[model samples]
Target: MKLSALLPFARLLCVTTLVAASAAQAQQVLNVYSARHYPSDEILYAGFTKKTGIQVQRVDSDDAGIVARLRAEGAASPADVILMVDAARLWRGESMGLFQPVKSAVLDAAIPATLRGAPDAQGASSWYGFSTRARVVVFDPAKVKREDVDTYEELGDPKNKGKLCLRSGSHPYNLSLFGAVLEHMGEAKTEAWLKGMVANLARDPKGGDTDQIRAVASGECAIAVTNSYYLARLMHSTKPEDLAVADRVQVVFPNQASWGTHVNIAGAAVAKHAPNRAGAIQFLEYLSSAEAQEVFSDANNEWPAAKGVKVNNSALQRMGGSNFKSETIPISAVGGNSLKVQQMLDRVGFK
Candidate 1:
């Protein structure tokens, strides 16, 4: 065919190619393998996309399942980020080499140094905690006076024997608390505390933090151990009975006179083979921003890891007004010592 006759077809081909290229560029997505099952997380993801035009796709699973899937996928994994509900899970993922060291000034400046893991040789961090929850005490004011249960060590007092309620010893929340105690009080003291605390249980260790709160409300136990956020959830519930439970219990920030409250975290790490590295980092930084922090803290009844962000939950407000000191021990230390803490719990028969 003559040049003039072929010109229109050639032009059509170039236009199609350009359109395909543009579509590919516009289709940027960040895949998140998340162990956090909170419905509120949708708002954070949507807000990130609205700001940056990068879509987020999430696969929700238990921490172990998420880790196993990532390992199975290896370098070809589609996960751009790993969002977890506990420091131990994040630490486990990093230790297993599932995360890449991420460097973000926003993350570094907004999050406390202890919340983010220590920097590697090149000054990048493998994981960052965006929200925190204190493992605290809840007591029936009718049965236990506030001043009488001021510290964690007080829970083991003989006067409180047969009046304490707890979740299973194997739960990560309790494990991390035990880990911190081990870090501060050493093996012998922690072992002794565990023995006494176990002996004090009103019933066999059972249920989640929420169950412990309910037990306190019913006066089945005069005192219980639970995450601060769980009490926040109870206080904020639309159901009247849940609110009643909140009213029945008085909040206590344990160990305030000594080490401060023990805290665990909800955190994220960039997948080692993220397909959209820039978008992943941008999303991670967005999660660290003050706006996202508030949303997360309010939704989960947790505290923001970002400096200067306020805790908006009423339960938290009633407890300490957002300015109480938390334990200053590095969170990584708690995560690292988790195994030993579990072993001690098992040995002490903290069922």
Candidate 2:
């Protein structure tokens, strides 16, 4: 019930796994069910092992799969911790009772409170978002003026009809964005924006963020909304097509006046019935540490959750350079209304 009450159990969990899963010389292992598959995570996990002596057994899959599996596993789930991209998935998982509230002053200080909703948000989604990511707008400089779009609502303006590029609304990323919109502007305003966004789509929503960027490059649309990291990855990519796509799209942070760019998180939390609990919390602490965060950010092309972390890649710098000002609303609100947002997406004719 109370967070203070959970701390003792959470701490005992940390030590219990080290005993069960490890020999004297062997490090305690944490089985992490992660929604992230970026090669950068592997590097960070390796670094965590080297630093904390805890072995990371990561299972990569989509958020839905991890949540569903955790639910199916129930008390027997081998998963000690979970890492996921969108905040909604974390909240969704929390709602399903897949995660337990973990208490750590270090983590509390390290992660922002707004990022980690209390269990009340889901009555079970006890997890919190740790990493920073923004859903932003990008355009072909030659095709669209920077000032032409600032707020997400403007993308749906009639004059810009059929001039915007975006991915499927069902995509968790777009769902999160719409979730944020719904939080701030209410269901009515958000639905209107979605309808406008659907009408302005250059074509049926199909493909990932890169595809939207590619569409912009190929004259499919003048403007596209995507994560900052996607554009950063494209810029640094060795692949010619991605490089060309990067060359064509110009990055812009939207909704700066009221709701800065919509920033979401990829986060981790200990399982409620974790077979290896302490190891899991240590693993979470390890991830938020400077060393792991740096490696994760650099290798994965993402912004670090902890502050004052330097960004090495020039491409990352060019794409807004790690500003975490964030949108005015909490990511949990996005998770809470994800279903309504998806329905709106469909109602607006976004395929």
lDDT of 1 by residue, 168-267 (tens): 9888888788888888999898889888898888999999999999999997999999888888888778999999998888888887779888989999
Per-model CA lDDT versus the true structure: 0.87, 0.79
> How big is the positional error of residue 107 in model 1, measured in Å on the Cα after superposition?
1.0
- Backbone clashes (count) for model 2: 5
For model 1, what is the alpha-carbon lDDT of residue 287?
95
TM, every model: 0.92, 0.88
Clashing pairs in 2: 13-278, 14-278, 94-124, 94-125, 95-125
Candidate that would win on lDDT? 1
Distance (Å) between predicted and true CA of 319, model 2?
1.4
How many pairs of residues collide in model 1? 0
Which regions of candidate 1 are displaced past 4 Å?
Answer: 1-27
- Scored by lDDT, model 2 comes in at 0.79
